[model samples]
Target: MDVHGTVAPGFEAVRDVFAGIVAHARGGAAFSVVRRGETVVELWGGLADPDAGTPWERNTLCVLFSGTKGVVAAVVAALDVLDPEAPVRAYWPEFTAEATVGQVLSHTAGLPFVDAEHDLLDTAVCAAMLARQSPLWTPGSRVAYHPLTYGYLVAELLRRTTGRGAGALVREVLARPHDLDLHLGTPPELDARVARLVRAPDYRISTFLDDPERRRIVERMYAGLLDSDELVNSARYRRAELAAASATGTALSMATLYDLLAAGHVAQQAALARASRTWSEGVDALNDRPLRFGLGFELADPIGTYGPAEVAFGHSGAGGGRHGAWPQAQLGFSFVTNELRAEDTDTRAATLLATLYDAL
Candidate 1:
């Protein structure tokens, strides 16, 4: 299915994108792109299911996992947007963790993972635990991906000050202002637009379940974290805010929203400018995980094989659910798919990146 659309008179950029999608589809993946605040490519041609019955669709929504943290950070950035001096702790008093707002924004707060032994569904209690949690390293000593913790920390802080849940605040203050449809929790009205998530071939491992050591690691990673995915799909989880990972929306909205944020339109750019310094200057190749991180954002690593050298800021989901906003070119790019594949790893996202950079 071709979700391709052009906003400008030129067609070459769009054509290249289509070609890239064709490449991905033949190889069992999907691709999309946006340029200058307009979607130029929304191409999808792959199987969303094993039997190949449901074709990959443009509206597919999948678990972004850590990638969704960027969005949550952006929402927290709203506070800095409105009031840069407002102590982050002022919003979240529990944030007395030996770090400052700048450190958190820069991903040096030293709170990388939650207790990992607790349930995650409980946001308030878990967030309070983080406030008093010990620092993994001296605050701001080094950069590491705060994969599961950043979102909860930011949400708790935002909630303390704003008196509104992070999900609602994001919708009221940010999304509504920009007219973007990106949402943290899936609203009932948007249910029809949600594409059913298609599980990838290697998503579930009977081995991980049966393996003791692996289970121990998994348990620690989200000790208190709730089984949110299962909850979000339920009516209760939809109403309940799971800002860390339950965000559900299209790639189009995600790109467009971030483009506006990066371009410094709705709020002041000065606030985010300070944190814009590249956090992970180069790949932490030794760190085991291959992801590249920036201040509350991410750049596709050359080694991971995703995003562009000029990647302004974007987050990606496993199995090709990706979105990015290009500030340099005033471009907003988004891509989504129900088709999940095991081979479309960090390297393949890079192949998509090359196609996009060439289009530019």
Candidate 2:
């Protein structure tokens, strides 16, 4: 594959690693890294839309998937509006669960699956249904990955506090000020720039149905949403404000967002530190993985593959998008791809990160 983009002096290894991954991957991907507020590496390659022959450009945008959590988390932490200890009901008066703002952000609130029938885009109805439902476990007592529900819950809190949706808040507070291309809702003009996702070759619902309880929980959280390519690729899905996983942007934009947050406003930096502190870690029974979370950010595991520094924080998408910052190193990096891959076996991001740190 002919990779495009530049690497600063001494960072050619990152380009080499990215080129190797793109050579083996079906779809295109981009990676960018920022150190001490300067961009060190920017690279992209392969086909953005394999069928139509669209080349992946520097600004090509792909769905961030769950990596959107980090974008939303950055905005939330930057705004520094919500009191972490305050009950969610304090802001949204109708919230029935006893989860504090911090608990909700940290995925410690056990309201993962909403048991009501409602349209996914109907934010009002969905939020109301979630509000009325009780948590499956005591809030803050254990960690359960909320998956789709986390976005809605956080969006409602953002709505109540800022009178704006996650997308709008992100646009006004993060994108505009920082001049980043990140967005929750893709504008009509940028639709052409959005890359079509290549479905995972081995993805099958049966793969996750091995355990009965896991099946039940997984189905409730991702049954229709994960399976429907039509729904995910539709215009409505791109336009609607689904904050949990609907974010779209290039690797540089994501890296820049993380970079700015690491060195920008005092409140934002403080919030990032607080949110990046280990909140929960271990085998998450719901996702059935040894996952860990800070507030809304994913932290580096004991192995530190997420980043070389233990203080590295960011989020990864369901497939192969990884974006985060090594705060102590004052470095931010992102690897985004349209090709879906099982997280367990995907080594693209880890390899690129390893090369990046080594180059540094």
Q: Which candidate is the best by lDDT?
A: 2
Across residues 90-153, which tens digit of lDDT does each residue of candidate 1 receive? 5566566667665665566777666544556667777778887887787767665554566677
Compared with the true structure, what per-residue lDDT tens digits does model 2 show for residues 1-360? 689999999999888899899898778999999877799999999889887878899889998988999988888888889888899999999888899999898888888877877677666677889999988889999887788888899999999988988889889988888788988888999999998887777754423236787778777876377675677777788887887888899899888888776776423557777888888887666765666888789988764548666678899887778999887778789999988887666788988888887877
Worst 10 residues of 1 by lDDT: 200-209
Model 1 has an lDDT value of: 0.57
Name the TM-score of candidate 2. Answer: 0.95
Candidate lDDT scores, in order, read 0.57, 0.83
Per-candidate clashes come to 18, 0
Q: In the order shown, what is each candidate's alpha-carbon RMSD?
A: 4.8, 1.8
What's the true lDDT of residue 80 in model 2?
Answer: 86
